[model samples]
Target: MVQHSYAVGMFPATLISLKVKPMNNQEHDEAVLHRLLFQINMEIADQTPKERELFSNSSSHFIGPPQRIAEDNIRLGLMIVLFLAGTPLNVTAMMRLRRSMLSSATPLKQLKQHLNISDLMILLIYTSSQIVWLITVDWRSNDLMCKLLKFSHALCFSVSSNVIVCIAIHRFSMVFGKSTKRVTTVSLWVAWTLAVATSLPQFAVWTVYRPYETATWQQCVSIWFVREYDIRTKNKTLLAEPLISSTAYSVYHVLIVFWIPAALLIICYLRLAMVVSKEIYCECECVKQSQSTPLTNGNMPSTDQHVTSSRRLLSRIISFSSSSSGRFEKALMRHQCVTMRRKRNAIRTCLLLIVAYIFCWLPYNAFFLWGLIDHDSYQQWHNTSIAFLRYLIVVNSVTNPFIYLPNFRSALCSSHAVQS
Candidate 1:
């Protein structure tokens, strides 16, 4: 793999060299490679059939494996499990939350107005693409299905990334109390429109018919990525000829999901934390003052008395906040401001989701980058390692949704109980 990586055509060198910045990450990459190799070696007890052929009959001058197909099945099966487990929870939660917000007749009625129907549609389409691609037949062997699959794949992948970016930006605006209306409107339209636009190149560049040896059938692929080297390379990236939009899609993901958006997430969260912390502190101080002041007696108040006094003060303050009376009006304005900030706490949550995506998918992206570069290194035995790594990475996606379930247990329980 290293040897082929040094040579011209494989995906790694292009990926590696394409970067403008010299990586401080090489050591990490090397360590990761070692771990992957060790895992692969442990999994495969024999010389792989694919490696054996590539070293022997293959003109590509590769080593090991007659086929990595079985290894792929194992890896993909695990991914499918993790992915399926995740979808129901994360998507359902988002869907339900949005629905709840929209249906509410409560004070947070603003939430309904902000829930863009287009963005919701985009999210659903993206989720659908994931599930659809998982269940569909291997389209690589057939012309029509190949194009359709590739197109939908690109649509799902790109739109999801874009939507995430939009969501993050929207939340950022909300958190800072900026012009959320503009951000929301822009992001909503861009998310769906670009989603449709991104799918076009996938259809355009796809040949629809793939070259397969007599031994090959319409079985699912060993590589989930046979991405093109350049969008215009007109050749295979690793093992597959992806659409012309492939390079663009990869670049967008790397930037939005990994680099640019990640930095923005950190910044937004820092700002949000500062804002929320200040608000909490102010409220805490006011409440403390109210609690500390005795009835001119400085005597300790009974617990119930303290609670009643606090509730009464809170109610009076809340009511005063709606008033236009001179001195009380200023207090009212402050209260309204704080109340608005609380509603915007949802923005902080959006940034956190960005953080979550970074943590969850970073390994998978790194693996893809490294493996594609080292495709030559990916002998029959190497496939086992790649498979194992892929399984672990995909597991993140599944675990993400379930991991948060515990946090929302009360809500889930209430929803279930209500239904029951």
Candidate 2:
């Protein structure tokens, strides 16, 4: 009896035995052994189709189908557009902001400039990764690189979202607290630190995973734990589970990225609007009272002169009430006017940003949540919807400059004129 062993791809080695009749010739024994090996090869070849069928069936249940090539081409084209458009827009916005800051380095202007910087970082990180994905089939070949890319994408997104929140908070403080300066250097540093800390978990949760154990391509996917499944042949297979639970992570992401910021923005802007309306109403009343005041000469004053005389009379009344009170009232009114104007401008800029954020991010987050809740149904349109949503998110970065740059430039020019 002669025994031979052979190993096939991803399969255990097996031994086959060949029995030969008694032969005195060594050459004949060798030839018989060769014939038996050839027969074994033919049998193995005949079994290849069944093995492939099993693999295909098992893999289909987990890995799903590849994305349609037409959809992929469209997605790639859109990503290229984002890269071309967002890059230049962000760079231009950053430069314009820097130039303005050089001329007038106020706390508010600095905060706005910092926001531009955050958006720029987000555009760079996300667009670069997206471009790589579009260009390469197996971009996640290296585990370390995969983890780093996923971490960076999350970090940039969190930082940008938090920065928008910071802007809202800063405007709220300035409007309600009657403060000129908001968002100090310390506060900005703290905001960024928190953002970075919030995003750190991504590095731990994401890693390179092989959807098919023997497949050449690897995916960068979120992995919580190892799960084992028994297939038809009693073969056990392992799959990666999500670390934070898909539902939990989806809820957390939506809350942090969308709901909280949207709520804060709405509340702050509404309160600020009411405050401005009240101030304008009071100013109008003061003007009417001034206009109604009779002149000693009994000659009606022109509109400009009437306004000036009314202000003077009010000042006298305020001074007569108490000199310190009069001075305080004048200073307060001046501060209120300046702060209110700045607040209105800030609100306008922030409203555009918040609206853009919602428009771009909400659908994507909603889809993600839906996928988590009912993955089977969601998988039907997963490739198409996700690709579109991702492009929409990138569009936000591209649109920000167009939406806010004009306002920023006009504000900058107005400030220069006032300074002159």
> Candidate 1 at residue 80, lDDT?
53
What value of lDDT does candidate 2 attain over all alpha carbons? 0.54
For every model shown, what is its TM-score relative to the native structure?
A: 0.53, 0.65
RMSD of 2: 15.6
Runs in model 1 deviating more than 4 A are: 1-68, 90-95, 98-102, 105-141, 179-182, 195-199, 209-253, 282-348, 368-407, 410-420
Q: Which window of ten consecutive residues has the lowest lDDT sum in model 2?
A: 34-43
Q: Best lDDT goes to which candidate? A: 2
Residue range 1-420, candidate 2, lDDT tens digits: 222222111000001122223234323323432111111110111112122222233324354423324544665677678888778767877888788888988766677677777677766776666656655534346888766766676666666666666666676676566454634565677678876776666666556655557665554544431121122113322222321343355456556655676677677667766776686667656645544652332243334444765877755654455555446656666766675576567778777877888788777666655644564465457444555665676677777776666664476567679999
The 10 consecutive residues of candidate 1 with the worst lDDT sum are 35-44
Task: RMSD for all candidates, in order, please.
Answer: 12.5, 15.6
